[model samples]
Target: MMEIRMILGLFLMITAASGWNVTFESPTVTVHMHETLSVAFTAIVTEADVANGTVVVSTTRESVASVDDLPVLDSSTVNDLVWSSNLVVSGNFLGNADILLSIVSPDQENKTSDALSVIVIREERIIDTLFTVFVAVMVSIMYINFGAAMDWPLCKRTLKRPIGPTIGFVCQFVWMPLLSYGIGLVLFPDDPELRLGMFFAGVSPAGGASNIWTVILGGNLNLSVTMTTISTLAAFGMMPLWIFTLGSTIFNSANLGVPYSRIAMFAVGLVIPLGIGFLIQKKLPRVSRILVRILKPLCSLLIIAIIVFAIITNLYLFQLFSWRIIVAGIGLPWLGYLFGYLLALVLRQPGPDITAISVETGVQNTGISIFLLRFSLPQPAADLTTIAPVSVAIMTPIPLTILWIVKLIMDRRKKSIAASAEKLQGSTEPIPTVSASTKTDNTENP
Candidate 1:
């Protein structure tokens, strides 16, 4: 019979000032989806607490927690509130969410609640599970199609080439993740989810489009395919390991709700499609080519649709940011590009190898990133987490697309010039050679 709000509580503390002190009389709260919940707390103010103050509340994720019946503060007293599901989480949220409570003064001085955590538990939704499974299946097919176009002969040829994969693996697994972590510190030092989001972006495998871009950019297709395979396979081991390792260091171990098991399952799942593609290539080249042609366009359409769906569903989260996070958000991918290309160049690799490694390094598996972020983590975080990868997904392709276009133009111009020169030579008339007798007669006449 009252207002409903969605609550995702990820606590962010605004450290206390010498002023007023506020504490939750009851440190922990538990609530359910439909029923109402209540919380009790007390606050005290002294002359030392100089400024007017209000309670600050936030969920761990992007959205604010939905609390109803908030009490008015008097310098020293107990207050109570009955919480109802907010419009956002009214029927959708599940899991234990930590609700951050802080007192914000006029001057921005604040104090955090010593203890407050909300654990909202719900059963798994069948619809959500089905949708996730559908997406996983689609991803498998997309990778299979990706593998179909792979130049196997070239893959074998480059299999022994140590330099290219060395450069690529270093950039993909080592450099980008480290850079993402650093940027997360600079930009979202206070926000664990944002920082973790960046870390995941770094750890995501190179997308299907990386191989596509490599071919378009006149890079070695063999190396591109090889790198994608290696990284995809490596992700099974690395993604979960990185999530566990980085989760502890970057955020207080409490804040990170990493679905390590889910990540491992998904990473391992990729091998199925990869092996299928290998079989197709080995058994029937003609069918593989047809599947590649068909799947390429189809997979692209599916990817675009999925991206659009994710953005639209979580558009509100993206709106709640200043240009600071946006720049920090978008900056990660560009940094990957600059650093990857430079790393490859520094290794003294050939031009084609450099281009292939650079593209593979910069372009992450945005589809998988979006999917995992959406389904793996709890809500609000999932929505907020997609921002960096979505930005990367949109921005990373521009350079490769432009390079491909420029290469096409240059190739056409070269062909035109060569044809022109050939035509001119063919059209030229040879100078008539003067016979010896004719030359002698002409000299005598003169």
Candidate 2:
């Protein structure tokens, strides 16, 4: 237990150091057209042994100038820092423009800080607002389905089986990501955007709500909890390595740009929410339960809302490249579940184990994917944001539907066997026949 706690603590620290504590000094700014503006930003470090870190800062200013138009007047680095770049903003400068800054440290593996930003006043429209709504809707549906499943007595029963939960956790955190990456190679061979999307999905640890899913599926709750804890802790390092290694290998093969800082940010977003959830679960189980009940639905709704909004916002992109994105989107999640189940079967796991593994393997941390898509990809901001959520949105309903079908089939089979046994026993029993002749004979004899 002490070792586990230590490991967990280490995991949190790594995640916090690598992924969290990213903030913009001024997220929003206003400046006049044709005026040179400068903004100061800071990257605050909060962890130890950070080795080297990089920061990418960007702004939206299509109306005023292209990114090249904004150039850094002066740049300097201090405290074990080796590299820094001054951004030149270019293009039409009418409304809003973005300035980007990147920082890299060579030898430090601890907490570090940097500051950079640019000045330009452009009208900012709420982009992907509708998509946000769609994400919400999908999150809601998932929560409802999950909540209903939790009401089943079999849920608890299934969870009590040890092998099931253990296998489930292993498959989810360890195997599923590998499978997703392999599949991405086949499906999006030449497309960096799609490949990265798939890879990101694979690397993210299972969401906190997976514990709830385990309970719903009747897998051992303690095992699920343990797995969730362990996997999340493991994800701190695993996610970064996966993103860096796989992203570079695959995206480089395709000549697609992979942004490291953005990926780090994505990891941070996932880890923070998850860490908070774990802390809550540990410190206050009852409160955590209530929050889960509330947040699960909210997450489902948010996911659905994001999907619908993506469709609408990117209607043009979809119209042009619908087949490519659609096929990959639909295929990835199903593939995830399929491979997950296959792995469990190969391991000779029991039914409950199979179910737990299936859920864990099939569900990717879509939220992380969204953050990556929005921030990291080389594509236009609108295009990447519009398409990223499709991966999760398209895939979310599938496993739930399949699980429901499996449950129904299993239940019917169980009932039929029970009924058949009862019928056979009744048939074997001798029936006592009270014949009229017997009564008459008895009376006469008497």
Candidate 3:
């Protein structure tokens, strides 16, 4: 123990005696992908140290940024015991990494300088802009289909009952935002950008995907559609309200400005298509029915397109996904489902209403969140903040898929059993029954 302590003390003395310091012109540098940047740095050392030591600049994450010059500093670059060298850094990917300066010495001991932070951004291509526009246009068109599917009289009756939609509304706005905030606090306490992303996703309206999930999961399709419409219409106010109030704290922490105009535009976009759909539904019932028939497949296509385009356009973001981010992703929607379900169950909502509310609460309109982030924030941050929303969007459909599969298997088994029973009885009369689970509740009221 004594020898170990003495050796440790000697090593510390040697380290303290090796006086070498490297300082950069800037502590941090932001570069666009495929661009090269020369980072100027100065090192203070003795003549002998410079002669014996080789200065190497490298990045902690080579995938994010690569150092161009291998040996950035050496004796040749040094003058009068002081050396100033340029480390050429090239952005290879879109993310953050640390640039390290090190002095390797065989005669003495090696020393490494403090990290220089690098932020790499991917420039938005024309295709990216076009893709965003495409998403917006497609979503608006899908809302027309949404509108065609709405039964105004049934909507009015559902409103009269008001239990399911009311619960959905509260869950979507109240519980979701608060839950996301809490999750961000717990999971990513130091990352204000991620917290803001989660908050933005939380406050956004219910997605059209929720209605599709409801249809597949044998939920109240009427309630799901009605809630989706109501929540979207409400986003014009609710989103802004949340963003200005509690969301303001996160925005301030992240040094982000709330884009009030863009949000209002998003709400307006939803309303216009929906209004046209309603007109078509009421005036041209036949056309509305035709659109309604195609609505499911069209919505599925839209969902696929959104996910595929988002992934393709921001392929770099997948690299940013960490365990904490993944947990935040999975937790947000699943917790929303739990909260919505428990709330409705506590209120004695019928089974179908419970499913509808749960689906509505869990599935957020991440399109709005992504759109707002991309348009509102500048490059890099626009991409960075998107991680949270994209994560949630990707994770949101997983459980629904599993549930749908299980439900399909169970439904098939039940049908098979019914067929066997009919065969056993040797009856020619066919069984008058509904085999599929996608039935709407006869009573909209609790």
Candidate 4:
């Protein structure tokens, strides 16, 4: 019966894919004239009974524009894939346009792969590019600002304290990932995109922002820094392993099979950059400092740009499925944090330690998840693309917000305690006194 049900499900999916329906990972994109855009397309083949399959993709300007006015752009096909010939658009085609991509398989009677639609808007506004750059800068700034403090000799000494480094490492690698898995399981059981996002979050090591959180929470800053370093290094291996394992499981459950090579590619993309950065940092401290500074801001800008692009592209998804997604996004992070804090508490750790663990466990690497979804999954890339940003936008802010709230409360408490102590000190001070002889004379004479 189970096997039969699985067969039925597969049949239904194939049926859904064969029609002339339009699907887009991102419905709209903002681009400048001469700017290049890349879009992914898929064709699902259902029936084994047909022949002569071919797919054609074309774009039509919204206006009744002339072919000459449409700009003489070129297109190319690579293995069943079609893409814009150049990364840059040289045409004057501006405003909204419909990009039509079709797949026709000769041997198959029905082909039902979900088609991804990408829009090309021609303009010279540098907003998205600038935003991407800004995100990168912010990320670099975070790393440098926090990373410098970790270099101090005293910080190194403090890191060697009893179980400090061990605990920190555990929080960075083991506890946080496990906690993220638990959160994903609970909050996004039905949504593959959300689940994948959570899985990515679980696998990602704490970035530099963690160091700041540790200091603010009164945990050993040195320990946090050390943990972040170790985790970031270990991520080259662990991140891929965790993603492959968890992603395979999640995709399998969702009837999508992910290939091992795809997983390898993702790991390589992530780790190579990280490894290069680490090597530069180790080999040339001065150069590394400069790179880190540049990269931090660049990373921040990239993150924001990616997020904005994602949101803009999937505007329809957000509008259509707003309530369900919003709830999952808001609830999942909180649940993750709660679990992390509980885990820390159970271990009998300090409040700051607990806070660190909570944030690390709850905050995930949404970017990595997006990459995997875009490149690795067997399902239509468009679905993954749309889902990726939605999931990240929903999940990323949760931990950051929670951490901020925790910081505020901690700050207020510290101030209140200081004020109370000052008041007590003032009340208990001794009054001024006259000399002993003067006092005695006054008393006796009187």
Candidate 5:
């Protein structure tokens, strides 16, 4: 009985927090221009004492649309349907518009329902199962590999700088979380799943895989490992906090179920493989090198597979992503890279720490994002929002790969020049002098 009451109280809090106003049967009504659609509104007569003496309907903007008939209260419903109203958005509107219904009583009592947004445009099919599956598989493999790739010895870096972890924590918790929500609002405003996805993605720890990139990019691997460890360890508390904070403050949907089980599973996923990898590294360094080399390439292939399978699964949608999503994909990593470098510079960080932070900031574990999207959210929400993290994953490795290739090429050239100079010096021949005609003016020719 006590547990039941507690559950009931929690339910009540959720209901109260879910934005209750004059109840509309549907908060969103879509109709084409010059077409008509009816919306039903209701109120509780006992609680609100709501009545309908006259009905007035108004659109948010002038000359765009109109509504008709305020609903009346129904006493028949003991606990529900205390009152009702009917309104219509006339086909006069062509763009998105909001509508409000006003019920005025004989005693001069006026009650208004919350604004019901009428989308004045046609809606289309948004997602397919094939694309969603491709996304899930791709992200899952990468995360699994991240766990398996861990070398315990390689995981910790000796850092001369004391505050790198703190700086990374601030950026992960503060800058990125806010940026993610703002980005979500702009790119996928109508998608609640996306809002949740972006928020969680931001709050999630720096990717373990980023340490791989930091080593390649000439960043401080020790700093990278330390920051990654710090951020990831901190995630248990930080993720839920950001999710609830961002959700309640922005979307008014604190009632969205937090996937505590999934979060626990994710934590397990991170720890176990890394723990196993550490054992292998300690016992068999030779085996560890071979495994890391193999895992690195395998992870790269997984990234490519994600893109290829995504494109093949829904070729039409892949090519037809709205401009906003495309920009989001390419732009997010770029922002992380830029801001991270600048912040590190301000902190007077060593070169390795700067590179590590920049990469870590840009690279998030898509696995965590995918896990939340797959299990935490309901259908269609998961499918639609998976794109955000997939985008992050896709962009994360690209710049690093390009930079690595460039570094290799430059190193090869430097080595070639050094080798040629050495060969010339060891030729055991007299050194070549200036040509006789060219040097006559400046040299004493013997």
Candidate 6:
């Protein structure tokens, strides 16, 4: 019995000698990007063997954060050996990661502590604030410009035919949502945020830029404007319906109770600007024409600004970008363009109407997608998911730009040929003419 008790005591001592516990003043730390945070912690060593242990701190995700070793500030002898120190952490990106602390004893045995959660956030800047406000104001003005250019009679007539708008509606809501969902599933099967982002990008209404492109490419501008208006209005119901249904499935099959009131507010925001534009066109015709003239350039500038600012603000996300993400992004708008064109073609629509539908279908209001993601998801996730719309927005205009260049070249060539024909006609000598008497004298001499 005495020998058995001795062995049990030895085992207990050995077990205790290999065990250590670390406790932080706080279990979780939150830091801003480009900032540092210091956390104080205490390590309790119950055994004499680990009295001179070395502490090492590490983060699970290096991209998210970097943690420094625990610097010992003091040591004390009490019931057991205790060391107190501060763990220094630096935030590198926006996300959540785990911080782990381990102590290595003289015997090279390691004792690891429980994980500590860390969150990194992007600090807001003056430029971000200004950019948000500028986008809001510019979009409103652009819509007003769209209203100025709208032909109310033509819009009504297009509605009477309804084929063009119908095709656009199907393309915008049906084809786009499904395409985005499929692409998200195939490309980012494990990432729910990106999938949600793609889904929102698809479900957003057609932007006013569609109208600009239609006009630039000699499409049915009237129909494009009408479709934009209808699509914006329809989004009030369709967005939520799809969000609660298909969107929910993509997000772990959880029924996401989307904030309906916020969605309503957004819809109202869009409609109010459009209504203001319509009023300006009706009550102030001269101002409307001026707005119309500036619309194209202003919209172009806004597109550039959106791209540049989005890239600048979210530079960190670019690191997470992959070829799959790029493929998914390019697939959304490019496939949308092809699908819309084919659908319209199969329906035997007029060429101009086909162009209008294709443009409206391909170009989504990414601003709205970003807004919805921010509104729906929590911090970090909201910002992270924005990658989807931002990527799509960057890619959406490429094909349109190419088409615009082609149209410009063709127009110049046509003008050159017409000018050459005119010059040749002008330079050609008049056919030699003969008087009746000259002709008779020539005949007699012959």
**Model 3 agreement with the true structure over 26-108: per-residue lDDT tens digits:** 99899989899988888887666666766555555677787765544566778887888788889987767787666656787
lDDT tens readout by residue for model 5, 271-346: 6655666666667778767766676566556555655554453343343256776667666677877788889889
lDDT on C-alpha atoms for all candidate structures: 0.66, 0.54, 0.80, 0.51, 0.62, 0.77
Off by over 4 Å in 3: 1-29, 40-87, 95-118, 275-286, 422-446
TM-score per model over all chains: 0.71, 0.54, 0.74, 0.56, 0.58, 0.75
- Which stretch of 10 consecutive residues in model 1 shows the poorest summed lDDT? 1-10
Supply the TM-score for candidate 2.
Answer: 0.54
Give candidate 3's error at residue 354 in angstroms. Answer: 1.6
How much is the lDDT of residue 306 in candidate 2?
A: 54
Give the alpha carbon lDDT tens digit for every residue of 1-446 in model 6. Answer: 42343343333334444444778889988988878999887777645434566555556665687664446523443334666667788898887777766665666566667667888888877975676676677666656666666667776887998888889999998999999999998898866778888989999888767888999999998889889877876887888788877887765532235555766676667667778888988999999888877776776677667657767877878877889779878999999999999999999999998999999999998877776676556557667788998889989999999999999999999999999999999999988888999989999999
Best by TM-score: 6
Q: Count clashes in each candidate, considering only residues at least 3 apart in sequence or on different chains.
A: 16, 69, 0, 40, 9, 0
> After aligning candidate 3 to the native by TM-score, how far in Å is the CA of 103 from where it should be?
12
Model 2 stretches astray by more than 4 angstroms: 1-124, 129-170, 207-226, 251-258, 269-286, 378-382, 385-389, 399-403, 409-446
Q: Give lDDT tens digits, candidate 4, residues 2-85.
A: 234334334544454556443344554445434555433322332221134443333343221111111111222332332222
* TM-score, prediction 5: 0.58
Native-structure RMSD, model 3:
11.8
The residue-level lDDT of candidate 2 at 404 comes to: 68
Residue 104 Cα positional deviation in candidate 1, in Å, after optimal superposition: 14
Model 2 per-residue lDDT tens digits across residues 295-379: 5545555545555566665554553355656666666667766776787788897666565666666666575456446556533
Please give the RMSD of candidate 4 to the true structure. Answer: 12.3
Q: What is the lDDT of residue 405 in candidate 5?
A: 100
User: Root-mean-square deviation of each candidate, in angstroms?
Assistant: 7.3, 17.8, 11.8, 12.3, 11.4, 8.2
